[model samples]
Target: MAAPETRWLAVNGAKCRVRTKGTGRPIGFLAGLDGALTWTPFLERLAGERQVIVASLPGFAGSNGHDRLDQHLDWLLATEELLRGAGLAGADLIGSSVGGALAADVAAVWPGLVRKLALIAPFGLYDEGEPTFDVFAVRPGTLQNHVCANPENFAQATAQPAGEDAMEWQVTQLRTNEAAARLLWPLGDTRLALRLPRLTTETLLVWGADDRVVPPSYAGRFQKLIKGKTTIATIAGAGHLAELDAPDAVAAAILEFLG
Candidate 1:
């Protein structure tokens, strides 16, 4: 695959970094709380078949701050505007973690904008029994353990050279976390339960069997909420970041569903 082309899009005065790769059907990918810099092997595989457009959420990466846009609804509106600016309206959508919640919200509110929706370990609804981990409370090392099934892979992926580059990486992580906290601080739920019933687009939900951050049980909750056609797939031996832990499996499932 070739290197992704990067572009800055202005959505409601917020500059968002959008990365594009491959060609053909467009697939807009929304990253998780951690940010969108890391492109998992799953995404690379998907790129082979579709035009993948991944953007850093507001207040992360090169995107400008979103203090003016309050609430999750504003974020969804901004996302819709961003996609429209990129000429990706009616594109296939893929979201991870918080990104998943945003994608679902957009689809529910503007069903015509999304042709298909796929969510991987999405954070939207809250279940009292299967509560999500307090990501903000955990240290970086502990967070890694909660995020990845293979700690070694997490370490390797996050390792940075000791110098200004490493410092910059740390700063980026902090900023990304801060931005994510705005929406997911107290709890990750955005009351998507009530809105999901409005979704009419075909949806795919994938979860890791061993996801500690967001338990696999929430998959059932999503299945029940979506009134449209929905499919669920579980990738074994994977944790919260199933795309990173079981990229091949996750990619295959997504590809099959999108096909």
Candidate 2:
């Protein structure tokens, strides 16, 4: 299957890099780590099932420190406009990590716009006792290490022959952390924990069985709290970056639920 047709689209004070793939059914992609979406594999698997539009989303790297998108809610609003610009205003929402939090906000604010929502080991809940990963405070190495418990993925990413583009990405990752820390969740409630009760759209919750980042325990909370029908699936042999680790499973689950 062909990869999502990536493009550069503008949205409220920010020119977003958006990827539009497939055309039958529309589902928005929200990245978790680094904002540069890693949905290529999933896109390939689900190419025939539905249309997938992944947004690079306005952030610390591609963004220019605009005061308007400083608040998390504002970014969510702007993101919806970005999606609508990509011809996906009422499409299903697929959010991973930070994107999950944004997805929840969108469902809350525009209750009728979302057809369905999918969250894959998303962040932002900030459980009181469960260890919280401060995406900004950690070292780059630490972040990489946490991505895969096997440690091979980190070695693979680090060992891949270095190139000018890879170096640029590393720099972007480092700088974006600081800016993201400020605007990512300044208003708190990144999990939309309190707002789940009001969500009226059907949701599919995907989690990696080995996911130590958000932990599978939170799945129950998400399932129980959402007012809408929620289906849960666990992907084995996977960690936080399930799309990269187990893209096939992720794609199948998404296609089965959304298609």
Mind giving the per-residue lDDT tens digits that candidate 1 earns over 1-259?
A: 4668889988888788888888898888888755765655667888888888887778766576666668777888887887787767988888888788888988999979988999998988998887898878986566678888987655554555345377778877777778777777788888999899999999999999999998998999999999899999999999887887888898889888988
Q: Give the top-scoring candidate (TM-score).
A: 1
Candidate 1 stretches with Cα past 4 Å from truth are 156-164
Candidate 1 yields a Cα-based lDDT of 0.82
Lowest lDDT 10-mer window, candidate 1? Answer: 155-164
User: What is the C-alpha lDDT profile of model 2 across 80-173, one tens digit per residue?
Assistant: 7776787767888888766777776678677877888888876656666775455555564777666654556544533423353877666556
Question: Which residue pairs in candidate 1 collide?
Answer: none
C-alpha RMSD values across all candidates:
1.9, 3.1
